[model samples]
Target: MEKRYRLRKNLEFRKVYNNGKNFWNRNLVLYIRKNDLEETRLGLTITKKVGNAVVRNKIRRRLKEIYRLNLYRVKDGYDLIIIPKKNVVDISYKELESALIHILKISGMLKG
Candidate 1:
């Protein structure tokens, strides 16, 4: 994702977590809140419980790619935080994309 679309600040992530509506599936959890800007922002969280450094980074990259691919379809002006479950490490890219899209759709984050 682009620099402008990435949510990098701790306060921003915390704000989204505290105020946003959340949705979850077997592999992913999504937290979304409205933002004032015209573009959407994305944050990702892959905890240590998921894996070692290499594994965690891999998971993070996969999630970011999934989001990047689907970015155009998602609604604008929202802050989104995605938390992937440990099971995500075992899943294929297609499955990861599917799970992420499914959760986004159900959460009303994806535009029709």
Candidate 2:
């Protein structure tokens, strides 16, 4: 993802968490808030409870890739933060993708 489309700052993530609406499933939680920009931005949070550095990074990569591949299906002008649950580490890629798509649909961001 491009720099502008990635949520990089602590304050930015905080703003989204405090003001955004959220959706949750067994595997993940998604928070979303409106932004002034025309394109959507994505943030990811994989807590230590999930695993060690290697595991966390792996999950982060999976989440980012899922988002990138489906970017066109999501709505514009929103900041999104994704937090994966502990169980997510063992799930398959297709399950991760489905979980994300489900959350996006609940957020009303998935285009038909």
Candidate 3:
């Protein structure tokens, strides 16, 4: 059987582009903007700029995995859009996991 979470439209990916937020020393780039909703949502953007279809899908897969594994560690009431940098393709799952955790920590979603 398949399972799903309460993903809503407020989690829609909105563009912040050059106005995006950055946390140095952290390998992840989060473009966060508040959405007026009670449930948390995720919108992923993997463009051609990242690479070809295969590469883009791979990046998206890794990101989805990271988010799924860490979903319980996050807080509700906001829309979070994460964009992976080019360097992300070169890293392993553990590396990406750590990077995701780091971003959440800085975002004040995770403690310790």
The whole-model lDDT of each prediction reads: 0.93, 0.94, 0.66
Per-residue lDDT tens digits for candidate 1, residues 1-112, read 6899999999999999999999999999999999999999999988999999999999999889888888899999999999999899899999999999899989998887
Give the per-residue Cα lDDT of candidate 1 at 9.
Answer: 93
User: Listing every candidate in turn, what is its Cα RMSD in Å to the true structure after a full C-alpha superposition?
Assistant: 0.6, 0.7, 3.9
Which digits, one per residue and each the tens of the lDDT, describe model 2 over residues 45-81?
Answer: 9899999999999999999999999999999999999
Give the Å error, residue 49, model 2.
0.3
TM-score of every candidate relative to the true structure: 0.97, 0.97, 0.75
lDDT-based ranking: 2, 1, 3
Q: Report the candidate with higher lDDT, 1 versus 2.
A: 2
Best-matching candidate per lDDT:
2
Rank list by TM-score: 1, 2, 3
Error of 1 at 30 (Å): 0.5
